[model samples]
Target: MVSITFLGTGGGRFATIYQTRSTGGMLIEDRGRIHLDPGPGALTNMARLNMDPGFTDAVLISHCHPDHYSDAEVLIEGMTRGGINTRGLLAGSVSTIDGIDGIRPAISDYHRQLPSRVLSMRAGDEADIAGMRTRFTPTRHTDASGVGAVFETSAGTVSYMGDTAPREEVTASHEGCRVLILNVTRPFGARLRCHLCSEDVPAIVERLRPELTVLTHMGVKMVEQGPEEQALRLERMTGSRIVAARDMMRLDIGDSLRVNAPTLL
Candidate 1:
């Protein structure tokens, strides 16, 4: 079964440091373990949680922002076993691969030349990774990781809305998604500049009516109301499963998916 785990749950400048809180991205393990968005706290957070960064069979960088692709070089080294080989696939924006202001060359030439493949994609392009199809859905956010990802799994389609505000085009692509991971960086009614806030989710929820809507990539300010509570309110408001994304949390894909964390089982 294909399973996904969030390595870091918070996003933006402030990373959770109190104990085990994380930021920005996650680890997806299907036939292989793929690391998505190695943000500021990704490596260290994975280490703390005993999830090895070296085991990532593939790496998907959503963009070139520091909070997203900052650790790409480090994680790439680990994934290739200190540059021994690049057995994993690397997928992201062209800037993240070819060359962007200072973000280019995140992966070494030797590793890039390895068995792995790198595809630079814009909006509406579909790429295949480990039997699952991924489409780069355009977002308003500008960064090295230009577009968000839509994962088409064996069970169903899941949309990873990377740092997008309320956009009809973005939500349009999310229609019929079984799982939707929205980057609700702020609490309800608190309007964020570009990131999504809690209150803004109902529209997407009501429109898409996804079977499961997971809220993640929170900012420090969102910590005040607590993500779990926000998730509960969101569930009541949207009539959908509002999951509070947390580090090491896993979900299995099947006829019906089940959410389980490392500590839970």
Candidate 2:
């Protein structure tokens, strides 16, 4: 079975600063453990869930933004047993791994050496990550080289639409996935540049029609407006199964998807 854990769901600068919700990112447990994003509070939340970072098989960062990469190096440290061994994969966007457009690399050179393999991934690049067929998908975020990812897991295809505005190519890349995790930073009528808003998600959900569409990475406004209510509106608009991910909420995917009760911090 494949299981997904939402470590933290808050996003955007203000939200991250005030921390209305945690920004720990998501964790996927299938054949192996893969941590995506690893933003602030990732380690702390993992401890809350009784997860050992040393067992993580890979770390996937989508962009250079702090909300997406802050805890990555430390996680790499844990994955490598405090750098005593090179044991895991570190895959990230060009900007996140190699730096681009003045944005510095997220994983330091010292930390980069800790992972058994380091991939500076771009959109369309594919690799074997902890037994999953992983593909780097494109994003139209402020970080020009930012990328999302799609994982072909044993249970089904899981796609993460990283920080991006609603775009045709973005939707096309995530098509035919059983699960689509969107970084919905704004609520309805509160659109922002390079970020997905509530209004922009309906068409994407309608077109792809995944078994589940998870709304996460909410900003202050979206959180204040009530993510659950926003999700309900989107579900009504698209006739799709949509959920607003809470911190520590777990989803088990086997023959079907099941949302488990969240474990609070």
Worst ten in a row by lDDT for model 2? 256-265
lDDT of 2 by residue, 62-126 (tens): 99999999999999999999999879999999989999888889888899888999999999999
Give the winner by TM-score: 2
The root-mean-square deviation over C-alpha atoms between each candidate and the true structure, in angstroms, is 2.7, 0.7
Clashes of 1: 7
Clashing pairs in 1: 8-23, 9-22, 62-145, 63-144, 63-145, 64-144, 64-145
Model 1 scores a TM of 0.89
Candidate 1: where are CA atoms >4 Å away?
Answer: 16-20, 100-115, 262-265
TM-score, one value per model: 0.89, 0.99
Tens digits of per-residue lDDT for model 1, 82-190: 8787567788776677767665655566656653677777788997865577888877765624778888777788788887777899888877888888888899777
